[model samples]
Target: MGYSVVKMKIGNSLEEDIRRIEAALEVVPSGKNLAVDANGRLDLETAIEYAKALEKYDLFWYEEAGDPLDFEIQAELAKHYKNPMATGENLFSMQDVRNLIRYGGMRKDIDYLQFDCALSYGLVEYLRTLKMLEEYGWSSRRCIPHGGHQMSLNIAAGLKLGGNESYPGIFEPFGGFADNIAVVDGYVGLPDIPGVGFETKAELMKVLRSVAE
Candidate 1:
């Protein structure tokens, strides 16, 4: 995969996670970035501990260290960790996102936001969220939607988002972008077709057609 950033899941155990991160760093080529996702599995103490322990690696971001809605945990972690952090994949509404921005202690300068339009509501709501971020002095470039699907890809391209997450060789027909567009040097071009470009993925298009029929 020509991705510049690779993300992995953590929060299993401090020691185990450290070992795994070291092992992953060994294989990932130089100049590439690695991100870790805990999926909101850690407590405040453990999340801070992990943040301290993993700070040397200079990870692209630590994701969802505690319950997604817990602003205190996130705020406390931010005081201890200076590196970039990411969350909001599970945040479904603009109001929830507003709360995160207000109380989550997320630094707009360094942190990234992963609000997936598909998971939240739709493009309309996502547009509103983007507007909200703008109002708060945040840039649209900090957003990288969570879903590894074409809908988010289209949104990323159209809205100039930071980047879109991708899952190659996973989730079968539904998790990737257009078949003809190849990722090169960690960047990929969007499909030329109109709409969200779902029809450009032959396998996914087949599945969609079957469901409709």
Candidate 2:
């Protein structure tokens, strides 16, 4: 994989997570970025503790340290954590995202937003969300959708988002891009074909056709 950033899930235990982060730091080169996703497992206190402990490594972003809907926790955590933070993957409606922006205490300059269109209300709603972000003085470049699928990839390219997440070997035929495309130096070229390029992936096409029938 030619990924420039590698993200790992944390919140198992502070000691264990530190050990894992240290191990990852040893192998991951200095130029590349590393991120951690807690998936909303830690409480406010624990989240702050982890933030303090991991602050020295200068992670790419700390993701979902507390419950997604808990704006207060997110806001308070921002006060303690100085690095970039990411959330909103679990936020479905534009209203929810709006609330996050209004109350989540997210810094537009340094933090990133991970809002997956597929998981929420599809591309139409995602466009609205982008517009809302713009109204709040946030740039479209701060958005990085969460799904590792071609639909989100297309959104990333067409809308010029920060970047789209990739799950190369995790979800089989549904998780990656076209078979012909490859990631090079942390970047991937989109498929030239039409309609999200699902036809470019043989296995995914088979599944789609089967569902259609």
Candidate 3:
């Protein structure tokens, strides 16, 4: 319902997912400070079993426990599910999201939407598609990004949308090339520092200049 303070995954077993879900339920007070995302990596049956296992807990959203572009599979998965399912990772275009909606998942079980700016049609293009998501009865703000983790983080910091994924390890390694944001405590906040807030390898640059010279 609202932004969750803690998020998690099943770690790789139905039994584990069930136990974790129960523990999270005990802590999060029905519907706050907890959002669980599976990252789209389970079989259909496994997903269903996991979903059935945690009927009591109010999940903020169930992320892609399956295929990213397989709208057809997603369509069937979202059907008649009690908890809301979400998708949109490793997705490359607005068409991916549109197809997720057009197929059946979006309206049926796709409760939340996620996107990675690097993989999708870029942030600008994805932003345009955000408007389209609403036409299908979805919210752009609900779009918890997958890789735009930093961009989404900044947006979430402003309380703009649901929330953003904090792939600290993954994004930080890549952030050496550009700007990046981090999630502190439970909210996303940009660090104020020199040179986009990160140090650079002058030696690396000098090597390039030397090669050219």
List the RMSD of every prediction in angstroms: 1.2, 1.1, 5.4
* Model 1, span 51-151: residue lDDT tens: 99988888889999999999999999999998899999999889999999999999999999999978878888888999999999999999999989888
* Candidate 1 stretches greater than 4 Å from native: 30-32
Query: Of 1 and 3, which scores higher on TM-score?
Result: 1
| Residue 190's lDDT in candidate 3 | 65
Q: What tens digits encode model 3's per-residue C-alpha lDDT throughout 1-213?
A: 123355787638887777777777787767445667777777777777766665556676777777676676677776646776667766667776677778846653337776765566655776666767767777556776665334445544443566666543353433322233334455545655443322342444456577789
lDDT of 2 by residue, 1-213 (tens): 788898999999999999999999887884138899999999999999999998988998999999999999999999999989999999988899999999999999999999996887878888899999999999999999998888889889999999999999878798888897889878998777778877888998899899999
TM-scores, all models, native as reference: 0.96, 0.97, 0.70
2 in model 2: Cα distance from truth in Å? 0.9
- Once superposed on the true structure, which residue ranges of model 3 sit more than 4 Å away at CA? 1-4, 24-31, 108-110, 154-160, 168-186, 189-213
Score each candidate by Cα lDDT.
Answer: 0.91, 0.91, 0.61
Q: Cα miss at 23, model 2 (Å)? A: 0.4
Off by over 4 Å in 2: none
Cα lDDT of model 2 overall?
0.91
C-alpha positional error of residue 33 in candidate 2 after TM-score superposition, expressed in Å: 1.2
The superposed Cα distance between candidate 2 and the true structure at residue 60, in angstroms, equals 0.5
